[model samples]
Target chain A: MNIKIVKTDGDVEGLAEQKWVYSPSVKTHFFHPENLVEDVNGFDDSDYNGVGAVGSPACGDMMKMWIKVDPKSDKVVDCKWQTFGCASAIASTSMLSVMVTENGGMKVDDALALKPQNILERLGGLPPRKVHCSVLGDKALRKAINEYFRHSKQFDRMVIEGSVMVDPDTRITDRDIEEAVLEGADDMDKLQKKLKVGIANKDAYAKAEALMGKFMEKYYG
Target chain B: MKISSQVNKLLKDHKKHDIYLDHAATTPMDPAVKAAMDPYFCDKFGNPSGFYEIGLRAHEALEEARNKVAKILNCSSREIVFCGSGTESDNLAILGVARFKGKGHIITSSIEHHAVLETIERLEKQGFDITILPVDRDGFVNPKDLDDAIREDTILASIMYANNEIGVIEPIKELATVCRNKGVLFHTDACQAGCSLDLDVKELGVDLMTINGSKIYGPKGVGCLYVKAGIRLEPIVYGGGQERGLRSGTENVPGVIGFAKALTLCQDDKDKENKRLTQLRDKLIKGLITKVPKCFLNGHAVKRLPNNVNITILDVEGEAMGLFLNELGIYASTGSACTSKSLDPSHVITALGLPYEAAHGSMRFTLGHCTTPEDIDFVIEVMPKIVEILRKISPLDLDSNEVQEGHGNLHYK
Candidate 1:
C-alpha cells in the first residue's frame, strides 16, 4: 500500500509501518495509506530477512527498517519501518524501505552505496541540516541486515512461521512477551513458571515483562 | 579604600591567564585612569555637593572632569548629563523625550541593542507609536528608509551608532541630518562606538547620544548622555536636583573622574590608535580567511568597527568552539552577553538573513587599546586548530581534504 510521508519541507511515498523511530529536535510517525499500521506484526521468519535502525539521541534522529525476504527467490517481498525525528527524518525512512523492497531484496553492497541525496531527492529535497537525517536511515538499514547474517546461529530456524526474523543474534523468546496479554498464560504463577524455564531465562523475561507493561501503559492506558 | 593584596593577586592572575578578546563587552581599566581615580576614593573623598572647603575642592575637580568629557565629545559642559550606565542613559533619553512630548511617533532600527529596543517597547505599551526600520545584508539601515519611516507625528528617531553584535557602523550623521531637517529629536546608542570612533555632537547633529564609561576603557557603572542645547527632556529619576535637573542622583565622583580620564586619553591618540586597531583587525580577518575554510565574515568589510572581526565558520558549533577557546584561555563571545545563555545564535545574525547553520556558527572578536600584535598572532595561530578539532567531531560533514579543495577553488576563482 502506498503511503504519503509528509515532512516539514517535503514528502515521500512509501509503505509505512512501525519499527522503532527517534528524532531529538522534533516528533514524527509512520503509517500506510490504508489508514492502518502496515501488517509488520504478521511476517514469518522467512519473510524477515533484514532490518536496520540508526540515529542516536546525541545526534537527534533515529530510524528503524524491517525487511521480509522470499527464501526461494532471494527477493525482498515486503518492508516496513518507523522513525522518530523531524518530518524529514520520518519521510526518509519510509521512502527508503519502499525503495529497497520495490527493487527486490537490497544487497548489502547496494544498500551501503545509497546516498543521502538519493533519499532527499525522492522526498523532494530537505533543508540543509536535515540532509543528515536521510543518512541515518541508510546506515540503519545496512547495519540491521548485516547483523542478521553475522549471528545466524542464534536463530537456527531462519524461516519459522508467523515471526519476522530480526538479526539472528536477536531472538524473540516467549519471555520477551510474557506480560503482553500472552494467549497462553492464566495468571501470575503460570506467567512466572513459563518465564523460569522459558526459551529466554528469568532475567530476560522480567525485563521484557516490564517493557510490555510500559508499552501497554504508554499506548493502551 | 584599597582592596586586599589577595584580591589584587587574584585580579592579576585573572588578567595574566585569561586572554580577553571581548573588549566590546568591557575593557580592563588603564593603570593611569585607575590612578586618577585613587584621589577621589581616599584622602579627597568628600561629597562634591557638601558645603565644606574640602567639598568645594572636590566639586571643582568634578566640574573639571565634566569639562574634559564634554571637550572630548565636542559638546558644551552644560549639555552632558552623567548617568548610572549606558542602559540608564538610553532609558532616560527615550522616556524623557516621550514623556516631555506627551504624544508623538518614534523611529528606530531593528538591530538596536535592548537598551534602546526595550525602552521603545515600554514606551509603545504606554501609547507611543514606534517604527522599527530594516537593515541590509551589511547591517546598514538605509538613510532613505529613515527618511521614509519619519512621519508628521515623529518627535524622535533613535538608532544605534554601531551594532553591538555585528559592529557595523550606521550612517548616524546622515540620519541625524534628515531628523534635523524634519525637526525631530535624534538619539544614538553609541555605547559600542564610544572609544573606537570620533564624537562630534555638532557634526553628527544628534539631539541625544549615549556613551558608556565601561565601553571606553573607563570604570563600569558610570556613563553620560548628550542632550543638545534647548532639547526639552524630562527626568526619569526624580530626587534631589542634580545633572542640571535632567538626572537626579548623588554624583559618582570617582567613576566620573575615571570616565573623563579614559575619554581624554582616547581623544589624544584617536587617529594613531584607529589606524593601529584597523591593522590588527585586518590581520585577524586575513588570518581567518587563509587558515579556516568554509568561513564567511559576518559584518561589513570596510564600514565596520576598527577593532571588530566577526565571522561564521560553517559546520562547527559556536558553543563548543567557545568552550574549547575558554579551555585554551582565549576569551571571546558568540555575539552579545544577553543571548549567550541560550544555545541559539544572535537574533541580529538571523535578521541579516543568514541560514541557521551560519548563525549558529558565528563568533565575535573585538580588540581594545591594550590588545597587542602578539595577542592577534596567538589567536590566529590557535583558533583554526580549535575549529578543526570541533568540526571533526561535529555532526555536520566537514572533512578537511574536501574543504581544502573548496578553499583552493575559491582562491583560484
Candidate 2:
C-alpha cells in the first residue's frame, strides 16, 4: 500500500479510490428500472388503456408510456415505460413509473398533474444540465392521460401541457407544431408535411405557419 | 514484500476490479519516471537559474533532459523550449507566429483539438483570415485540399499528428510538404503521438511541434515545443527570460526530468510496445463490432493510433453505455451529449460527415500499459448483453428513417 500514487496530494498517501459520480437513488433506479415495457407485438396496447410517446431522437431523448386504468375507480392500475435517453433520463422514467403505481396506482388525475420536480425530488437530484431529461417523463405521462380521456369519450378532461387548439377538426394543437420543431422541422412546408394542418383551413394555416416560425426560433435559436 | 524485478515492478495487481482504458485522458506516471523525479522534490531542491553550485547542478540536469528530448525529436537542444502544459505550447506556437506576422491568413483542420482550433479562432477574430479544412469520412486531411487552400497571404498552418478522440493519424509529412512548397511554416500538435508514432521533426519536415508529458506516462504540467532554428516567435509569457525567451517561468525541474525519462523508455520500447498494443487494439475493435449490433469503428481502420478503439453503438446513448460499463469496472469515455458540459456531441465524429446520431452513441476506449487481451474479451462478452438490457428499456427504432444497413451487420426491425 506504500506505492505512493503520484496524483494524490500531501497527507493522503495510502490509497485513493475514484468514487462513482451518481447518487444512490439515481444509481439504483438506473441499474434496476421498474415496470419496463415488454413488446407484446401485435396487440400490446390491448393490455393498457392508453399509450403516448414524447420527444424525438433528433433532440437526443425520447419517452413512451403505457397505462392500464381500472374504470371502476378511475385509477391507474399499471404504468410501464421505455426511454431512448441517457442515464438520468432512464432513471427519471423508472422512478416516475414506480411513483404512479406504488400505492396501488395513483388516481388518473393526480398522475396527470405530476411535475418533473416531483420525480427529481424523489430521485435525490439529477445533474443540473440533466434536469431537462426528467421533464420528458412529465410530458409523456400527461400525454398518456390525455389518451385515456379521449378513449373514454371524456374529451373535456384532456389536458396537454403548453398547448392551444390550433385546429378544431384535425385536433392538432400548437404543441404539435412545437413537437414538430423539436424533431427538426424548420419551415412551414416541413411542418405541413408532418402534421398536415393547413389544407382545409387557409387562414388558420397561415397563422399556423407564423406559430411554426416562433417555435423554430425558440428551440433552434 | 513486493516483487523486485522488472516485470514485477512494471505490473501490479488490479486489486479493485478496476480497468482504466481511458489513456487518452491521461496516463499514470511510470514507476521509473517517478523514481527519476523523486530527487528534485526533496533532496535536490535548487533553482536552476540561481548562480550557486546547487543551482549549477539543477541547470545541468535540466540541460541533460532537454538534450534527450532533442535527440529523439532530431532537433538541436537549443531549438527545444519547455512550457507549462500542452495547451500553452499550442498557444505559444500559434499566437507567437500570429503576433510576429502582425496579420495574415492561417490554416488548420476541423478535427484538430481545441488547443489548435481555439487558437485559430482567436486569431480569426483579430482581423486575420483563416481557413479550416475539412477531413475525409475516415478522418484524414487531404493534402490536395491543403495545396488549394494555401493563399499568397497564408503565413502558417497548424495540424495535429494524431487525433485524441478517434485516434486518427493525419498525413503530417505530406501535408507539411504542401506547406513547405507554398513557403509557409508548419506546426503540429503531437501530444497524443509520443507513445506510438515517430517524433523526428526533420523526418516530419515540421517547423513547430508541441508535445506534453501526461499522455506518455510522464508527469503533468511539463511540455516541450520544438521550434526550428531561425523561425522567430514572439514569446507568449514574459518573465526571467528562461527557455530562450519563449516561455519565461521557473523551470519545472522534477517534471522535466520525469518527462525525459518517460520519453526515453517509450522510444526504447516503442517497437515492442506498439506491436503489443496494436494486437490488443485490433482485437478489441474487431470483437466489439462483431459482437455488438449496429456498431462501427469511428476513425480510420488502418491509419489509427495503436491503442485507440472508438466505436458507435446504435440504439443506445453513449453516456448510458459508459456508466453501465463503469459499474462493471470497465472505464472508458463517451462522445455523447451527457458526458460533456454542453449538449453538443463530439466534434470529431461530426467532422467525419457521418450521421449526426452516430455522435450520440460514440464511445472511445484508449488502451494503455495495463490493457490485455482478457480485458478486450471481457468487454466483448459483456457489451452485447448490456445493449440488450438497454434496448429493452429503449424506444428508439432506427428502422424508420435513413439507411437500413450498418457496417457492423446490424439488423433493424
Candidate 3:
C-alpha cells in the first residue's frame, strides 16, 4: 500500500503497509531494503561530548542516540543512531535524529516535548495498535539527551582546566566551577562555611552553591 | 465495487453452499454417526454401570462401540479410554504418563498442538525438564533429532501424528521406534491423523495415543485415549470408576456411539475418501501456488494430511484476508484463533523459522468428507482478488503513495 505523507508539523497523514512475517522475538530491528544507507559520519570521536541510549529488548525496541557537543558553544552539534525495531520504530528514531540535529542548541525541555503521536502523525498514521511502538523511539531520544549530559560531566572532569567569573561575562568551564564549589567542603558544615565564603567575581560560585544546597538538602536531609 | 466496501458491506451475500474450509477446527456431524447415536439417546440411555437388564443392554452397546473403535484402530477394546475431547485425551496421555512416573523428563516438538505443548510446558514449570524438538522447513520433525534429544532423564516422548495447522504428518513410526529402544513411553496426538491415516498401534509401538471424535465427523465433546495393555497411567481427572477407572466420566453413551460410528465410517471408506480429499487438496494447493505470486506452501507437499492446504502469501495480512473472505460468505481461518487478537502470527509458524511477514500471512484450508469440488472452485476463484485488494491497502510498505484516504462510503448495493 502507498503512503502519502501529509504536510503537517506534528500530524502525519498517510498509511503505509509493509508485509512482515511474525517472528518469535520482537527484539531485533528490521530494516527495509529501500532505506538502507551508510552510517552517519563527520564527527570527531574525541569530541563526542555525550550519548544517550534507551528502550528495551523486552519491548522489542532499542535505540542508541549519539550526540557531540561543541566545547566552545556548549551545544549539541551532531547526532546519529543504530535503532532496532519495527517500521514505526525506525521511522520514529530517524525523525528524532533529524529533530535533535536541527535543534542543535535546544534545551532538554524542547527535546522532551517530542511527543510520540507527533511522530506517528509525521509518518502519516500507524496502525492503531502499533501507536505504542512510537513511544520507544521518543523515550530513547530523551534518554540519549540525558546520557549526553551525564557523559559531558565526566569529560569536563577530565579535560576542562579553570573556573571563570561568576558575574556572567567570563566563560566558566563546567568542571572548574563544580570543582571550586566542591573544594574544601568535606562535611555539610564546611559546605555551609563555603556558602558563606565571600570572594571577588563569586556570583557563579554562589549560584553553584545554591544549586548544590538544593541537591544536598533533597538527598541528605 | 471497491474492496473495503465490498467486505464491510456484505455479510451473508450468497446462496452457494457455505464452503467450510476449516475442518481442522472441526467437521460437521455425519448423518450416519447421528443415526447411530439416536438409539442410545432413546431406549439404550440407561447407565452402563447398573445391574438391570436395560442397563445390561446399555453396557453391551457401550462395549460394542468400544470394540468397533478398537477394530478400526487394530487395537483391543480394553485399551481405549474415552474422554471429553481431543484436548482432554491428549492431557490424559501426556500428563497421565508423566504423573504416573511422578518424576521423569519429556521430549516434544515445538509445532505440537497446545494440547501437548501446553501440558508439557506446565510439566516444565513444575520442575520437569523438557526438550522441545524443532521441525524442519516442511513442518516435519526429524526422527534423528528425536533420537539425539533423548536423555537418561527422559520418561516419555509425545509427538503429534499430524500437525493440525500445516497438515504435515509426523514420522510417527520412526519416532516411536526411537522411544521404544530407549524404553520411554511414546504418545502420539493422533487427533488429526486418526480419521485420515491408518492407525496401527502395534505397528507404531506407541505406549499411549490420543484421538478425538469431532475431528472425524463425530459429535463434539468426546474423544478416546489409547493406553497399551502393559503401560500403567494415573488418572489426571479423578472421579467415579468408569472407562476401566482410568477416565471416570459417566460414559457419554450417545457421544461414544457417534465416535465409534465415525471411526468405523472413516475406516470403511479410508481409501476412497482419502483419494477424494487428496484430489481436491492437490487442486487447491497447486492452483493457489501457480496463481498467487509470492505464496509459499507451509507443510510437506505429499506427506501432509490428505485435506490440509496451508499457504503463506506475501504482502497481505492473513487476518485481513480472513475478514475479507468472511465478507464473501467464505469461512476460513488463519492457523490459530488463540492469538489472533494479539496481532502476532502463530507460534507454529515462528517455530518453522518463517519471517514475520510470511507468518502473518499464513492460512490453513482443511478439507473434509463434506468438502466439494465447487467449494474448492469458489475459493480458487475469489482468493487471489481478495489478496490483491488487501495488499493494496496494507501500510507495511515504505514506498506506497495511495494512503487509503477514506474510511468508508463506497457502499455496494
Write down the TM-score of every candidate: 0.63, 0.84, 0.64
Interface RMSD of each: 27.0, 12.6, 20.9
Q: CA lDDT of B313 in candidate 1?
A: 78
The 0-to-1 C-alpha lDDT of every candidate, in the order given, reads: 0.67, 0.82, 0.67
Model 2's alpha-carbon lDDT is 0.82
Model 2 over residues B1-413: C-alpha lDDT tens digits? 21122112222322323668899999888999999999999878899999999999999999999999999999999999999889999999999999999999999999988999988998898899999999988899999999999999999999999999999999999999999998999999999998899999999999999999999999999888999999999999999999999989889999999999999998889899999999999999999888987778988998999999999887788888888777667789998866776555788887887654677788999999878777787788778777776776787657412411222222222
Candidate 2 chain A vs. true chain A: TM-score?
Answer: 0.67
Using DockQ as the measure, the top candidate is 2
Residue-level lDDT tens digits of model 3 in B163-262? 9989889889999999999888899999998778888898877888889998988999998998999888889777887998889968898999899999
Candidate 3 residues A1-221, lDDT tens each? 11222344655432122223322112112222111122323334455555555533212334556666665665556666654344445556666566556645555546656766665565566554455445555555555555665665743333222443332222223332344344534443343222222112246546655655654555455
Backbone clash pairs for candidate 1 read A21-A83, A21-A84, A22-A62, A22-A84, A23-A84, A23-A85, A47-A68, A76-A105
lDDT of 1 by residue, B341-410 (tens): 3222476776675544455567899888767887888788777876654443233443334332322111
Better of 1 and 2 by lDDT: 2
For every candidate, the chain B TM-score is 0.90, 0.93, 0.92
DockQ, candidate 1, comes to 0.02
Q: Model 1, residue B46: displacement in angstroms?
A: 1.8
What does the lDDT read for residue B175 in candidate 2?
A: 95
